[model samples]
Target: MDSNNLDRELVGVLFPGIVKNEDKAITCLGGIRNISQVYSNPSKRRLGLSFQPENPFVRKIYGNSKKGAGVLLKVKVKKVKEGNEIKREVVSTTVVGCVKTMFRFESMCDFQYLAVHREGPSDGPVSCCLEKILPSGVEVIDFMLQPSPLLLIPSSFTRFEKPIGYAYTDKRHPDRSSPEPGDSVHSKTRMLRSSQVSPYTFNLTNELPSEPHEVYVKQKEIKFDLHPRLIEEYDVVKKLFDERPIWSLNLIRYHTKIRLVSLKVIMPCLALYMKTGPWRSTWVKYGYDPRKDPAARKYQTLDFRLRHAAGVRSMIMSREDITTDRERKPKRSAAEAAAVSDEIAEGSVYFRRGMTPTQRHIFYQYCDIQLPEVEEILAPEPPPGYLCHQKRGWLPANTGEICRDHMFRYIKDTLFNSNNTDLKFEGSGNGSSSNSDDGGSDGSDGGGGMSDEGGFGSDGGGGASD
Candidate 1:
């Protein structure tokens, strides 16, 4: 290797397909590339004029020195007969793409190169004296690379799709072990085949490995106490409303440790639930009016379409697995949900994927199997000013709705009754507080609820009402 040659660009030709005599390989490339028997690639599909004595492309390539360009040609083979000898002849040639022999100087290790013709005697044949082989850089082609559109590659994040497994709700022998008496009868034989190491030895009554001690891992003792009378719960719930205006059923059950059956009886006496607007699907304090209070901004709802940032894993469930998950849950009451107890509890372990610096060093010292990392996948944080707790614009409320007559035959004006707003005026903050001892729909005050004071993003007093 010459030191001066290291700084120089190597001349190379970027060919797409192998130069092979096989007809099938030529058909795959659509007759654009030449054949190996004719071009004679010495090694690694390399192109050098030094190899063959009868290659016809050498003259065509070297003849275009001043052009300073490499070319991809479409050539077809046809039989040519001269007397008794018949030879394969290239009858067609079309220029597909021309490669420019130019290079960008900055941060570019890749470039195209064209071989130049060496100066020689006028009567002598031209030759190129250079390295044995120069590696080529690849560039995309204009033609369709794939003829079929059925094949595709999915994202790596989608490792566990519907193809993995369906929902399995079997309660007994979750590991599929033979725990039944029928399974034991099936294993019966005239000769004793049971070994000490056999999995059949595993049973519910199997003794512990260490000393016999009390085991309580699977089932926790959840004792449901007798529910207090609804009249007595009214005062406790009113105090709860004073603490927080909005609460979900799960939070209601989790905080007070009350069963769902009692919650149903007590909830109607105090808080109200809405099907729409900011407090949709959750309990809202009955008498709190959004009109005069700054606290209304805390529960205000905003509508914005969410999409994962580019190149990030999607938070949306893959549709393929939705069917299995949907079948697991049927519509159930709040009490039934409380019994299932899917609420998040305190002191759960949330871990990162990669090992700590000390752990990494310790694990790198050996090549034994170890437990896999346990990183949790958390959702990306919302943009600033997007959360419900954030300060809102001069917008009256998150949303407000009109209460009109339910008659379909004629149009009617909205009904406004603000009298109930004074009923639970001592709820939380200002003259208005959240939580329900006596339930009322939104803006139950004298004039109209928050809906009369405009909503979301509009001038106050009947702005943005729907």
Candidate 2:
């Protein structure tokens, strides 16, 4: 019954050591009220008489065979008490396992091993035993599953120091009041060969504040000649932003033939990368507001799926038997597939699919993952973006969604949090607004926050303003 995992009224049990087949499967095991003698009576049956079943007792129960089996139950007390009085010495029977039926007409019971308890105990590490599991952590099953590519989400979204998933994404705009501490890889990158580009140049704000392409593309003429190629690339980036308020790395590099190394320096000044919502991983201009621009609305939000396929299968075998991937990915050769076919026929119940959100709310009430309550009335859009952690590298199930998610988030954050234009507006209105304000004077709202170094927002704008 466990092998098939179905429900039925009757089944057959094949006990080990017995040589009987289907024909000889039927046997009368005497119980407290035997029905055999009553059916054997030669007299006519009485009209008013009723026959109710009693507790079944079958001896010589072949315990080993799995084909036809009955449910086994163990009662610890194993005795019936009389009216507040003892009857005789009590001998309790220990039921080994629970059984289910293969079919309705089954004469022999089809049984599978199931440990039925009033309440499930907490899980822990233990050993195995062929006999009953006398204590914790012991199991009849052999070796456990090893994760080949276990995947999780929290680690990917980790912060460097301060407890913020949001962090320094762009060097252009640094947070003012939050200590404005910034992380830099320059110390290490500067050590690299001159030809190599830095994985990071400098960024103090996460998801660089967004702005209008008109305002975002404005460039400052800095005299620094440390890298002459950077000036050439910066000019080209400004031109591209003129076409659109947002641009991803590939879109910029592929079309303009810009060196990625140059982009590492240029991008932080031009735009902020979103980590969640709508424009997930894309880089939006510093002054472009997608929220107000109907044309940009389409790029602000997107929808997709997130699936967990890494550790779905739970079949355990010897380390040697695990020749290929633990999850059996990559399509093993026919022989290898066939060899493990019969072995891993049964799937684990732990990963039951098609479960409703309501079901999960109940199942995972105490778990780290929980489904938030749904609202019949839609709430206004606010932009947003456990356990048993075995130490192993876990590959995400699908990457397309990851890219989409990042792009969406980039757009959303750029649209909502970015108000670069306000700084420009304030500067221009005061008339003391420096020349740097010209970069964002294109009549577009852009972000220009208080700069940590000197002028407006970032050093790039500071030099222009000065």
Task: Report the Cα lDDT for candidate 1.
Answer: 0.32
Off by over 4 Å in 2: 1-224, 301-466
RMSD of each: 28.2, 27.0
C-alpha TM-scores of all predictions: 0.24, 0.24
- Give the lowest summed-lDDT range of ten residues in model 1: 359-368
Q: Write the per-residue lDDT of candidate 1 for residues 312-376, one digit (tens) a residue.
A: 11322332344432133457997776666544332111112221111100101000111121000
Estimate, for each residue in 132-245, the C-alpha lDDT of model 2 and write its tens digit.
Answer: 333246544443433222222232222221233558575433321222237444322213333122221222233334442333244322422566767877878988888777
Q: Total clashes, candidate 2? A: 60
Alpha carbon lDDT at 229, candidate 1: 60
Q: What stretches of model 1 exceed 4 Å from their correct place? A: 1-235, 302-306, 310-321, 324-338, 345-466
lDDT of all predictions: 0.32, 0.33
